[model samples]
Target chain A: MTTPLYKKTAREIRDAVRSGAVTATAVTEAHLARIAEVDPKVDAFTQIWTDEALAQAAAVDAKVKQGVDPGPMAGVPVGVKELICTRTGKTTCASKILENFRSPYDATIIKKLDAAGAIFLGKVNMDEFAMGSSTERSTLKTTKNPWNLKCVPGGSSGGSAAAISADECAMAIGSDTGGSIRQPAALCGCVGIKPTYGRVSRYGLVAFASSLDQIGPLTKNVEDAALSLNTLCGRDPLDATSADLPVPDFTKALTGDVKGLRVGLPKEYFTEALNAEMREKVEAAVDVFRRGGAEIVPVSLPHTDYAIATYYIICTAEASANLARFDGVRYGYRHPGAKTVEEMYVLSKSEAFGPEVRRRIMLGTYVLSSGYYDAYYLKAQKVRRLIKKDFDDAFEQCDFVMGPTSPIPSFEFGAKTENPLEMYLADIYTISVNLATLPGISIPCGLTASGLPAGLQMIGRPFGEETLLRAAHCYEQTSGITLGEPPIA
Target chain B: MSKITKQDVEYVAGLAQLRLDDAAKERLVREMGDILAYMDQLNELDTSNVEPMMHAMEMTNVFRQDVVEPSLPREEALMNAPVHDGEYFIVPRILEGDAS
Candidate 1:
């Protein structure tokens, strides 16, 4: 019997397709078979496009046989986050309100990937409207961590993390409102990048927080993340917010050398609040970077403690405004037999949205309301500016900052669900980057004593992804932490 | 410190247009209270002269071209709507004297 091919990276599969060792159709069938075998247990995909993916792969194979050159990512299996629009597939954002909705056009990022000849595996599950820190808020199905089924993979990109961890797809694209991408990737023992705000187009990503939203890549290694970002990052006419800077060759920058790079260790990040195991693992990873010809220095972000509260207020305010369009009249579920439009609008949202989403909406409306705008929303925005200044000052002395992605590794599924404050605190270390619009990447550093994975985050200046990718690739090469796979049930 | 009361929660919910049930209101009251208390940490930081920033970097006057561009077809734009009436979206009557 031929061996199944779920464990190969996108680059490896691309090589096989290029050398005629494995046809694109064969690679597509292999991933579909793997999904058929494991998706029921992992519950990663909200909608599986088996026939479409297969046909796309077959078309690539036919083109190759006819001596026509496909693009760089030809036949690579990629899972799109549920929030991204796909022309021929359903894009529900994992919410019951939009269960029947199908986008008539593809998102700009999706178009880029499609043009590169990447196979669309499916849309992965996420928190409803990308609000919560756990996938449990998804109205469709909870995506379980492939490593330990009882724990969450982290969210609102939980399904993307779970799919990459379970070998369901080679790479996935996720949107980070705060730590959505990095948190999930950390918990699931994969690599995820939250690119600089506006580095990638947000044209068709269902808006969560317009000002803070960014589309980035999640993969098994930093190199693949770099490769995916190479294809995904560029200015798009459809998205006015996209950056107009020159796109760098991310893959060529992965030289596995960080000689003389200044890596700063933030004192506020490793405070008394951090879990001991996570601290040890993150520190050890820093030691590896120090040994890799990088200079380590101590840095302080004075406004660090205010990041969580500030992020919640600003993100929720933006979310309340962004989500106001789902009024049952435009798109999403509607309540039947309502006597008035007001009642229908209220009933549809009341029934469609989950508790966390509703909570944020209420808080946002409260903050943005006439009476409290200066005290809450405006104050948060002011503090957000200071937070950016803190990073700006710190970067004057250091090239990049290193920290633990989450204070603790993946907790149990229901650990912080009851207390919304606890869930908000989980994003403390990762929120400041979004507020500052900086680039950050999370790579698996080391495993806890209990065998759970821990992630070390590297934050860089705006448009400094090349430096961050170089540093992460250097650590990854020297640390030799194998990308652990989930035990097949 | 932010003094949020049950009435405040209800008022905010009203502004958001969300009709929360009795159980949800009670739950939100307790949760929001804790959240607000934690937010008191901001009171400790001195921001007497700090300017509030709405965006991260300096980006202004980002207006697009005034030239006409192709837009989505009417049917494609309305494909995802739950209900629509020809040229406009259909909704339950919001006003007392409005005819459906």
Candidate 2:
């Protein structure tokens, strides 16, 4: 019996391919077989393209035989979040509205990954239009945590995180708009990074909140996260928002050095509201940094308390405008027997969108409406500036800011579903980073007393991914925390 | 200061074109009220002279050239629709002047 290829990290699989010990076809086949075996129980994938993945892996093997060096992600299997466009497969955004949608062309990142010889495993599930924090809001199917099948993986990118953690794929790409990627990564016990807003191209990424959305990598460890980011980052002409900056060698920066580094622990982040177990795990991670000759200082982000409210308003307002394109006439689901175009628009959106998505769209529409725009959307934008200023000031005093990614570990599937306010509050610590347009990462720090993984989040200055990765890499090395595998039957 | 009402929720849902059930409306009313109450903190911060910001970093006129590019064909664009006429979308009559 062969060990599952999905159980290994991208780097491990890449090493096997490089050494010729295992062919790319073998690794791809194993992952495809594993998805077939496990995805039904977990509901992680929205679309599985096994035949296409096998074909792609065979082409990669052919190139390797001809002495061609496929780039960093060579022969590794990865899952694309359903929101991103893939030429060969369907891209639904996990919404009933776009349930049957297929892109004629690939997203910029997809094209790049294909060129690097990475095989596409399939499209993973997500919240409808990436609105809600939990995959429960998906119009298609719910994505469950691999750790506890009843618990959510923490979403909109819940499926991607669960897929990676459950050994469904070697790695997965997810988007972060108000912590969609990191929150789920934390909950699922995987390594996920939300690159600085413009660091990665968002051209073909279905816009959630343009300013807040960034495509990032979800992997089993810090090193794989680095490798995935290497292929995904850089400027693209297709996306005007993509920064015209040089892509750094993220792997080269992971030398695991935190000596003489100043790490800031935001006092506001550790509050009475935070779960005691979560705080303890995060603090313990900070101790590892302290032991590595790093100084931990008490810092304050005074504006942090208002982050959730500001993030919700701004993100929803932007989403309402962005989603206006799906009016049933141009694209997506349409009402079968509507009398007029307006009725068609109404019926399509109402039927296609899940509850949380509709809630956001409503809130967004209200905020962006003529009379309310100044009081709500404009005010939120101003508050957003102050929030960013707080980070700018904090970064001057310390190299990175550390905190708990979520107030609690993975919760039951419908725990907060009834109360939308509670769900919004779950993203408290994470939304500020998006508002600030800073780089942030979530790495597994320790397991809670309940044995579920807890993540310690680190925030760095704008375009300061190198500093943040170095700090995380240092902790990852010294902490001696081995990756946990899901008990997939 | 954050005085939200059921009417406000209804009005917003209408603007969003959402068909909310009684339970959803009640739930949204409560949640939106709580959210608005939390947002009252903004009123405390004096903004007499402070300028409202639209983006975090100072970026201005971030646009691309209005270049003509290839677009998806009509058939491809209509691929995701649930129901479509030959060249246009088909829907129930929402306004008058239609065969009911």
Candidate 3:
């Protein structure tokens, strides 16, 4: 069966627009119509830029009329995560602190998407300051999983992934601090790629954890993820951490051949903690590679159990420092008529921050405090080094490591909310990738008995996105699991 | 690990410039203890000789030429300020209590 226009892949939209089979205006309108039809059920968007999107789409059509090459992603409608700054509207990061704040400049990735002729649909919701795993932490709105409206789209990129799954937008950009991108994509039955740290510029991505945050794409398929990465990767003088290495045309990496590719199965990831159904799906995904003439080797990342603890320390510490810039003096929310500066700072933060964000900030402050600094923050940093080394050692015996993207499939909203430790544990399988600074992708492997989708994750060497994309593309093609439209779709 | 006390939560909250009420403080004390106990597992790793991986990429002192580029207009920069006086953001008194 042919997919609906709203459900079409980004490449299909770009192809039709480029070949004059359809106008970019029509493509943009179809998506806007889809958003209007289904967004209330999914709650995937924080804002929908109908007028601005149509204007941008009209501009694309005008360029085509003038015989201008409108760029690789020409006429594709895309959503930018609310945390990624855009000049057009408020970038709230799903927190009340910046509810009315408008970015003065576009993020580096936003500029790149504009250059590529991608239409900015609008900002999507996320966990407040990208803190929680389940986007139940988003103060703005509750974004439900498109697959099962009662279940959560695993977050902090919950809205971004859900938008793609619900066909609200062809593709969306999401920043993964821990498993924000991959976790949500896995749960929502789509593709999400978190490129190696420094691979994509984080110039205007509102920092959650400066070290772990990398902006990437959540899309309908692996090919679209590769295409979006091609647009996003490059050096940026504005971001000192952006890599100086040359970016390869990521689309060129999708040869769909896994012959001679050595995939590693991390023994730590396939433990009893994983759900039985999800484990079976992941094993089936690996078998596809093995049957395609690729060798599967077993490897061990002994530090796997320590990943959650280490991640919480380092991520929270960095977040505390990064978010300190939000004091009332400069911009964002402020408490009116406070007697002293300290009181004003206290009141403003207390009112604007959600519970989880405040809890993390306090924890961060404690770890980085004078007496406990060495025991907590410094020790976690050293453990982070061990995590990175574990991946490095494993990579020597294999080209890429494979596992389940999340320990279990998507759970009901508020299932793990009361216990923060339990919520943090849900990120066990995905957090180590960020700690090691490696590129990782999550693709829908198969569906559970109840019809929920399960994702298989692939990890590659630092800056090894090309190899990662090649393997993902090959598996996505041969897996034969049809991309079923969600209930809302 | 010893359980974090309400006193510890209050001290950290003060340092972070956040004001938590009695209920928030009581809950945080218990939550914080559980989190810290879980985090103590890192002590099991023999990382005495390992160097901290601070930045993902091993680069330092990324310097650029000392040239000024056009910056955001003053109005645009203050656009999001809660209480701006058309030129600068207005905040509470810094030094004295009555200096408004």
DockQ for all models, in order? 0.73, 0.52, 0.84
Fnat per candidate: 0.77, 0.59, 0.86
Interface RMSD of each: 1.3, 2.4, 1.0
lDDT of 2 by residue, A172-205 (tens): 9999999999999999898899999889999889
Deviation in Å, model 3, residue A463 alpha carbon: 0.7
Best by TM-score: 3
Identify the superior model by lDDT, candidate 2 or candidate 3: 3
Stretches off by above 4 angstroms in model 1 are A1-4, B85-87, B94-100
lDDT by residue (B11-34, candidate 2, tens digit) is 887788777778878878877777
DockQ of 1: 0.73
TM-score quality measure for candidate 2: 0.94
Docking class for model 2 is medium
Pairs with steric clashes in candidate 3: none
After superposition, the stretches of candidate 3 with alpha carbons farther than 4 Å from their true spots are A1-3, B97-100
lDDT per residue as tens, model 3, A1-489: 465678788998988888887888988998999998899999989988889999999889998999998878888999888899899988998998998889999999999998898999998989999998878998889999988888999999999999999999999999998999999999999999999999999999999899899999999998999888889999999999999999999999999889999999999998899999999999888889998889999999999999999999999999899888888777788877566778888899999999999999998999999999999999999999999999999999999999999988888888999999899999999999999989999999988887788989999999999999999999999988765767753
Q: For candidate 3, give the lDDT of residue A50.
A: 87
Summarize candidate 1's per-residue lDDT along A364-460 as a digit string, tens digits. Answer: 8877999788878888988998999999999998999999999988878889998889899899988999999999999998778766778899999
Candidate ordering by lDDT (highest first): 3, 1, 2
Better of 1 and 2 by lDDT: 1
Model 2 pairs in collision: A337-B92, A338-B91, A338-B92, A338-B93, A339-B91, A339-B92, A339-B93, A340-B92
Best by DockQ, which number? 3
